[model samples]
Target: MRLSKLFKNAPTTNVTGLCFDSRKVQPGNVYFCLPGMTHDGHEFIKQAVEKGAICIVHSKELKPEEMPVGAIYIRVADTVDAMNQAARIFYSKPSDKMLMYGITGTNGKSTIANVIRNIRNKKEPTGYIGTIAIEYGNVRLQPDLTTPDALFLQEKLSEMVRHGMKACALEVSSHGLAQRRVDGINFDVAIFTNLTYDHLDYHGTMKSYFEAKSLLFSERVKPTGKSILNIDDACFEKLQRISQAPVITYGIEHECDYRAINVQILPKQSKFDLVYQGKTYPVVTNLVATYNVYNLLAAIAALHETDMDLDVILEACKNLPQVDGRLEQIDMGQPFHVIVDFAHTPDGMKKMFQFGRQIAQTHKLISVFGSAGKRDVAKRKVFGELADQYCDYIILTEDDPRDEDPAVIADQIEEGIESSNHVFIEDRYEAIRQAIESANPGDCVLLLGKGDEPYIYRENGRAPYKGDNVIAKECISKYCRHINEAVDDVNEDESFIEE
Candidate 1:
């Protein structure tokens, strides 16, 4: 546990635990001066020194006079990389203790991670770290980042190993990869969901975005890991060429190592024949949407590569419940149906609307959706165009108008809609009410955006907000009770007429 042992080439006279935040520094902790996008870690070096930091690891070159007395000063090319190395060494490289799966893509990362976690069974104590809460054994910790910093990630993995978890699935974001947040972890399996036009603001271009995502399969990852890829994706052909480990491909379009044949896409669920190694296994998933077919195959491929039996995989998937805010259905004795989903991206929105249209038998498909302000403005019009194509009625509303005018965002979306029948409501609650009140018997109301987001970001500050799934259930219960009372009154009038 000596500081010298943790830092191989650098001087480490005094060291304890490593931390990125200055406020969290302790008497013996080594504070890493990481320059973040919003704030500079170098600015807080004095505060860290005041808190009794024993060492300072920084990316910038500094004179000896700037160093605190009795504190070791080490300079690296990048502070993030230095922190990753220090954490990996400090935690004894915990990722090597168990089977670790890294899933990276623009969409479907959380859903795929959850599906794989569910299939692994609760008996083995599987953990998941992603956009949702991080689970270590029975303990759940809320996640502030899609992938936490290297120090926290290593610490969490260490805790998972200490808790005796046999497996862990993590969602690796593009930003996380670019920042070297997951630099030192050894992965047993790497998965790539489909890539699309997303996170262009940070990446600068689509090619750069994909390059950031491809880092998961780079040489820096564990050599023994296996790559599970969706071969049907256009980018997969190129990605397969660069992958360093053994590759396993899955798709419904072509003959892959694992394939889904005899597929039946249903209104409530989907049934498919999972063909692998020249044997076909029947799988019935409780999840809805055709896109889920891809998600399920990715999970199956990951498990199969680990030598999991097809029977166990099928049985586990059959009993798997729906994930929160991902195509969650709400029923409250209402004549119509309601679904809440987190389909913020253009491709995700189109897929959700298509699924809604398919299931809306003898009903009007009413969709309530809005574009996020100040992020990915290019996708706003695409979402609006898709809604117009598949929805009978469109209700445009607020979705995190962060520092931008909600009305302006709505207008941009409106510009893409060819139909003149859409209603624009800036207030999200009013939009939900308008959609619900307009629904009659044999109608389906679809709520999109802010699926499981706990807060709504605004110019002033964020306000506590419940998930759309919760709000949809409450609206359905209130409306159904009113409908029941109205039916009772109508029946009484009928009795008087009979008399």
Candidate 2:
């Protein structure tokens, strides 16, 4: 790649790749001196040059001495934007080559993204990038962030195009949007699940968080794109106002373009009538809960605008794959039902608890959950209150309490927990053990937060920890796994009901 492609008034030199980290700069690569939340890359320009960076793409004016004998400098107003522009050119604008489906919200993003990818994959090659992993063809990568940085994302999208993928389903996080991580994505379909209380630790307020989310609809979406929204969400109207593309609404409560009517929430699945345009189509989802109906509706609506057959999309919804750590069920032949989820926010917790209660019915619902350190502190007490209202017993345990005292975190959560039926357990493994041991026949054990995450963050760093579902299975083996017979096959029999 020529340096002139990155900038108009730059030296006509060849570059191999791009790098933001000074220590990782390779020979013939363009080093972007971007300003970040922690350290400014400008401070490490000398180190980058020493590490074999040939072209310095920086925002600051570097001294003549800083430019080494073999390197060239290209000063820009904003290095982040410059890096994104470089990625678009280098990666051949992959987002423009395929059908891009972008999902953004506080919760349900991973599930929606996965569902879309799986459905589209039935017809042609489709890629997915979200909290769990990134998959396109034979390539599967563990993601560090829900929405990865611009360079990695663009490269992956380009790879997907090379791998014969016709579509890419991506989860657009508020942090990714706020920080300009996904600046040049030409999203063909932008779907908003819902906005709730989350990431306030970074955004500081609900308004700021929503504003960050609004950027995708306003700026990134193509003018002819479709914006599928959950009209039932509180932020729907505001999102609609910001969306520059045509709006397609889906909800159970509101009168929308795609309405899920005559809904039935089952223990293992949900049945509903998808009233779209004017015709009523009977729909069955392998996933449970009412919120999932909205997810299905959003996915179906988005795919419909992509020129897919609505009937095939609806059939695919009937057999949707289980999104990892999102309401994942663990059955070790235990008497009680043990399920795990990534419901960290208050709104997510409330929904998970409601789903637990819905299935538990007369049976006891025991909640094992905790808040993270240095996060939205106000949501901690609110977590207690929601669990107190929905659970028969609550066990507060560690969920990434980095450098913060466990006792103090527990006290803050317990403030809103007026219920006298909860205990503070510092050891997460022991907390899970106690929850399983305390379960009775037909009872439900709910493990919230740290769903599929494989590490525990302490002052030392991210120590390895088995995921919530993994830990729950281990506990069930020790305390509750009485039926240990080896008789197994895939359960192809789906218990679905429709009106």
What are the per-model numbers of colliding residue pairs?
0, 0
- Pick the lDDT winner: 2
lDDT for each residue of candidate 1 in 128-236, tens digit (9 for 90 to 100): 9998779876798878888998888999999998998889999999999998888888788999999877878688898999899988887545677799999988889
Give every collision pair in model 2: none
Full-model lDDT for every candidate: 0.82, 0.87
- The TM-scores, one per candidate, come to 0.93, 0.95
RMSD of 1: 5.6
How does model 2 score by TM-score? Answer: 0.95
Model 1 TM-score, 2 decimals? 0.93
What is candidate 1's local distance difference test score?
0.82
